[model samples]
Target: MAFAVSGYEGGKTVDFRRLAHTGIRLVGITRSYRDGVLSFEEGLAKNVADGDQAYFDVLREADAYIEENGLPFPPEPGAWELLPDPDCLTNPILSLDLAAAGITTIIWATGFKFDFGWLKVNAFDEKGDPFHKRGISAESGIYFLGLPNLVNRASSFIYGVWHDAKYIADHIVLQEGYMSYAKP
Candidate 1:
């Protein structure tokens, strides 16, 4: 059967037509006229047809990594358990226990968060807020990097990480004046 599908912008339409001529049937246009909606089925179909096994392989590898690292859900749960410094403290219970055990200098590298629900301050909006325009949180002596919209709207890209890193370094330096570094 012959079909004339439309609405796809750019080279995708041409690519689809070329692929269709090669025995691939143009069943239907997948995308919607509305914005922000993605067509997963169509994307999957295209990936399968194109023999793009790399995508699925990466997903499988990520799943395996999560499983092996005891991060069955969020994909990297216990991956951070073995910190490079191993001096940083995370869990409050563990921190208290360690404190009781006479350990000091609990370095917390729990990473960044998009949600600010823990903060009782007005730093958050009606919804939990981003740390900065990027995705930093409001914990004292804490720094964040690699967040979306750190500098510009599109600062989430790899190029923008430098900007975020610089900001974090500056903040760390400034925090040194008010923050004391001693063993707990």
Candidate 2:
């Protein structure tokens, strides 16, 4: 959604792909369309979470049928501008005069947060993302194999999960590391 709103422009760590419906400013073609869409959704989740912006990316795109009827999702918050300083309150903009400021509108991006309350391990960070290296989370022998890019872009796909599962099984056959963490 951010990418779409940015008209495919990138940020410090972000990269954009052009949308045909949006405009012709930029275009990103990928070898696999499905993968690209999946990656976009994943990046959307991450970016919204990282920015601590209101997450209504569920409105990233309206269903064709729905759009035809005209549903107004609250407009997305501003193209959230990050300040040079980390203290968000210090630089709050108390007022803006549209004519004097040459501004058109204000959109407030409400941030999103993930909940890991059901997980058995103490692995999530302050932001609720599990701490991981490769596919391995902080909890010994526990793997977040189902997450996107646990080790690579394909990590959460069927093939990737199968490959990772096989590797885990092989390791279990040769060593008892996973068993050590398994309840006896």
Candidate 3:
């Protein structure tokens, strides 16, 4: 199948044909319609473990939705290919060596629990989350970024991170009285 990623204005307008809702919560994993108003399978309210069955269930639902809505399929046709081993999804062995691959940075985005112990800062709450006001902590020279609702609802989104970063940067520059140097 052909695939393309495009951007659109975000609001009430949702292109359900191109999207599916899937999430992993503390309760369990959930895969459903984006609006959650529709269910392809009966009794989909309960969470299930992430596995091949759940993955296929979602694909089947999406296929049904597309067919039911008379949405056009990709022009190209190809047989669906399954991964050789499902275990690779969880424990993927890297084929590329970072040093040989000339990789400088790796963003460890494990989407799991947060561990702030290495921060060595006392600016955290009892729950261990950083205690900050729009990324600015009580302790000077320390800041946070890309956290949910850090400044607004979009704080964690890619489209919103720059605003948060700029806010923090401006705060740092102003607080350090660097504006005097820029006056020329």
Candidate 4:
């Protein structure tokens, strides 16, 4: 998804392989849609393959984040402790699970599932739909255009992206210094 946007805006073709190089990982999760929503859990328990060391080398870029991010280096083998918060707890399983999963970032290319639960904003209304003023969001680089009555009633339709795409693409071009979002 990022590659697609970057390519369209940059006027240069990019590949998904860049995802791994950029400290992002992907896993396809099994899911079913019902009533215009997608639902899945990380605990669904499926086989997610791990990448080679070459791919994981991208994580070294985050090494400086160990102390600042509070994700310290892995404890010595067979060493384990759990801290409870305010009592702060450290479960080695958390890191071990991530390492075993080989997933630094998982991008699900599912469309229109309207599942932004991972977003850290209170962008939802009482009914859980995006509470944006029109399609704009308070969160940086985030916007919601295709939802019922988002901008206008038609903003959720196929034509919505046509209108909003230009805005988003223009923003991407400016922010990322890409050429254009025009389709070749």
Candidate 5:
């Protein structure tokens, strides 16, 4: 029940086993095919076990990380328990209908908030949050950095911060046509 990566609480490890005992399941969404459109549907079961190429690739990388970091995970069974038949694994999506399950309330505890009250522009969505493509606002020179999913899921991470900074720098240079801007 251990997660491969957990970065909650400013670097504190949570007891997921205890959480699981309380019927708290840690789950992730299966990658959806957008066909060039950015969209995802609730409970979309598009990927499963061995048929999911992305899953296999990520599993391989996680295994490598676990080994390199000398994690306590057992090597024999490894990080994931793969069954002989893919069908044996329960469907990634357990239930999609929350109302049917007697669900009357949902509390979104997403531990992130945005305060863009200072930015006066039309680069915002109905939710009052700045909507941009890879941090580039619709308005010129108004770029957002270190936002969640701004460039990808890791955009707020330290590694992502540096990567995004470089991307924004390059984008500014290209947009402004700064021929003297040197790249190291």
Candidate 6:
């Protein structure tokens, strides 16, 4: 009875219809947005331009259903009203609180980029920007899936993530030489 939907305007709007047609009752939907600046439509447009047609279609459908049924966009009660703190430091704690309040899981579909500025580790490229070599981050357990130049010029694309993911998986299993390894 559980149905997963991404947070985006066009694709989610479309996917919701398919779910409704399949007789799956809409219990809830999670909103994945950074800083609440980009709307669902904006996210979908970015995905479409990036050639993520599959994701774009899925989100378009789901959002349509929500609008048709007069259901709230996020579907989760109080989600829209909750404004994140300006400092952004409250995010993790707020997420934990939400989980304790009955949210079983969080689907974070947001795109990625370097956020290492906050970390004390001096992990960056020659230009002082965070460098993701082979999708491995300087921080342990933190890996970058889609980043340009990881394998090739277009390694940030979806197909490239698969190849990069393999290397990450292998490194995790064979942690002897991996820099991310640490003593328990």
- Top candidate, metric TM-score: 5
Residues 1-184 of candidate 3: C-alpha lDDT, one tens digit per residue: 1121126554322222222222221111223324322123322222222233444454677688888999998622222333232232333232334455465675545245568899887789998999999999998788999887688645877888899999999999888797577786
Give the Cα RMSD of candidate 2: 18.1
Query: Which pairs of residues have clashing backbones in candidate 1?
Result: 88-107, 89-107, 131-136
**Mind giving the per-residue lDDT tens digits that candidate 5 earns over 1-184?**
1122357666433433334446654333423423332223333223332234444565688789998998988654533443332221223343345545565665756355688888888888998988888788898778888886677646877766887888989999887676555544
Query: Model 5 Cα displacement at 88 (Å)?
Result: 27
Q: How many pairs collide in each candidate, listed in order?
A: 3, 9, 0, 8, 0, 23
What C-alpha lDDT values do all the predictions have?
A: 0.44, 0.45, 0.55, 0.45, 0.57, 0.49
Instruction: Summarize candidate 4's per-residue lDDT along 42-157 as a digit string, tens digits.
Output: 42112221222322333344454665788858733221211121101111121224344554664656455567777778677776667665566666567776666454434566
TM-score against native, each model? 0.30, 0.34, 0.42, 0.29, 0.45, 0.30
Q: How much does candidate 4 score in TM-score?
A: 0.29
Task: Please give the TM-score that candidate 1 achieves against the real structure.
Answer: 0.30
**TM-score, cand. 5:** 0.45
Task: Please report how far candidate 2 places residue 53 from its true position, in Å.
Answer: 24
User: Which number leads on lDDT?
Assistant: 5
Q: Between prediction 3 and prediction 6, which has the larger lDDT? A: 3
Q: Candidate 4, overall lDDT?
A: 0.45
lDDT by residue for model 2 (101-184), tens: 454563435334446788868787777788876555657666666665566434665756776666666755655755667766
